[model samples]
Target: MAGKRSGSPDPKRHLWVLGLIAPMSALLPSQLVLYTKLEVFWWIGPIIVLIVIPVLDWVVGEDGTNPRDEDYELLSKDRYYRWCTYMFLPVQLSGLIIAAYMWSGDALSVVDKLGLAATLGFVSGIGINAAHELGHRVEHLERWLSKIALAQSAYGHFFVEHNKGHHARVATPEDPASARMGESLWEFLPRSVIGGFRSAIHIERERLKRKGHRWFSVHNHILQAWAMTAVLFGALLAIYGLRILPYLVLQAVIGAALLETVNYVEHYGLLRRRRPNGGWARCSPRDSWNSDRLVTNIFLFHLQRHSDHHANPGRRYQTLRTSEEAPQLPAGYATMIVLALFPPLWRIIMDPRLLEHYAGDVSQANIQPRKRERILAAYEYRAAA
Candidate 1:
């Protein structure tokens, strides 16, 4: 979740209504892909994942507009969007089970095994996306479902860190989930993963302390989710044996990586200003980049509209709107993620925008500490010249 918005709307059923179908696309092929040879089936999910979705993201352009304020009120009560996420639980679990069955029992080459593992990872990542939506609500059922989905990726503690720590600290220097100005994806990955875990523990500890509970107890939110993950994976290991272990780990890593990539993209190089009162400025659309590309918007539950999601963290994704003030991404999450892997290319595309975002005032930006002096000198000098 990333930026700002004001309510607006159109009465005509907007295309975003179709967003419900997007997550299911990941599940639709589970059975069909299994019917093909391991070589062909293994590649099917990834192709639809890494290639087709991005292409659709490009062709469909963007819908920067939001539903009318009245429409939003109506949309919020519409059970369709909420139920869509609920439906995600079954498809995600079934897809994983079927993919594992095919991989474990069906004789396959090492290449196919890895490829199938990746395919399952793609679905698991999509499941996490759904869980993210569910996890944000105050409702008990939504929280439970969100944790269950997280179990598939073995990244359940994300539910706690994200809602508690990330939301409060996002776009600030202190937020590990927010990528630093000059930090490469390679550098951000390990930091975000390890630091986020630690942050979750810290946040959960503070929360329990407020409630008069000890941090070390299994009752801590982080441990509760992690225990769920353990039980889920333990059951898999018990039944599937050693061969399935690698498949599980590979998929889980990719799923978690998917989450990190989004976090990296969501707030890359953006920072909230520090107040004289020692508080960070309130988050605005300008503090986050946004992409309203049609395909990724729906596919990710309007998460590409990072600005609105951050501005209204509790706003249902269906009603999340975009503001013109946010930094616009050059492409959707799928494309940006690929670019992120190559730092030089990403820097070329993003660094100038980062400078431009701060109106060329390097000091206005929250920069990477190690290179802060070098960056400030170069960019600040360029602006002066």
Candidate 2:
């Protein structure tokens, strides 16, 4: 075991969190039950991850405290924290391979197969989250492992765009990752999916061009990730046959959607005011939706404390601290993601929060231009009355 940071929480205090890692590795065993004639708990993956985890989050509640400022350097530098994420790479890989194997065998029901895909997708989605934390490091190996993890989502460009493109332009109209006020998730999905990929490519090409390298050069990060994904999926197809294609593509879509949903939530309706010089305000803790929900933070490497992530992009996840000044999410990411699927409820719940954050001034909110008039009319009219 790596030495604990001075004044760190007792190992006994948070040992339970270590158990949260099981689902990614457990998918095979759960699905294996479906393959057996004597049926057992085959639907465990989604149930544990989606249903049970939320209940646990509600029960365990939030932890708002930060590591002692003096301890941050030692804590963040702890190799033990990094190893937990490194171990997940194989866990994600094995889960997908077993999922493809199960999907090829035709033993599980359609619902279970979809359940299986969604389950793996969500788990693998966390791999991207892991990659996000690892990608931000100054370490070369960690950054490369970050890209390797992202290949599971087929969103390899994220390591490039999120760091170079999204961070620089976040909470502005020009940033595709920031969801405008009054934009539905359904609407934001296609726009984000397409625009995000294009943004990544644009950022990468500009970077390479600056370095005097052609866009088509072997050094392209997007090509590197895509090439690995192609070889991976090609191998899966050859081994598992055509059935794995739908499974592969569906899981990838679900994984990417998981990420976009986070992007949608993190800064929905938030704006960084433009300076007189035409530059946007420096990204701040106030610009993102933050949650101190303990369980989700433990599972996602403290990504729920996103306010700090945007403000301090180089900070490791374990040290992400909460601030009362930052806007709060209504719930953890899983519950919020479920809520975001319904446009009506999502607006009813989130719009008021956005309005409150801006003190009822809709003009300050990042309203989707298409819905700008209606949204402003509704809120502005209410504020006047």
Q: Pick the candidate with the highest TM-score.
A: 2
lDDT, model 1: 0.79
The whole-model lDDT of each prediction reads 0.79, 0.80
Put down candidate 2 lDDT per residue, 195-231, tens digits, no spaces: 8889999989998998999988898988988887888
Candidate 1 global TM-score: 0.90
Counting clashing residue pairs in each candidate, in order, gives 8, 0
**How do the predictions measure up, each by TM-score?**
0.90, 0.91
> Residue 59 of model 1: what lDDT?
88
Clashes of 2: 0
Clashing pairs in 2: none
**Model 1: residues >4 Å from true position, as ranges?**
1-38, 216-218, 381-385
Could you list the CA RMSD of all candidates, in the order they appear?
Answer: 4.6, 3.3
Candidate 2, poorest ten consecutive residues by summed lDDT: 7-16
Q: In model 2, which regions exceed 4 Å deviation?
A: 1-45, 381-385
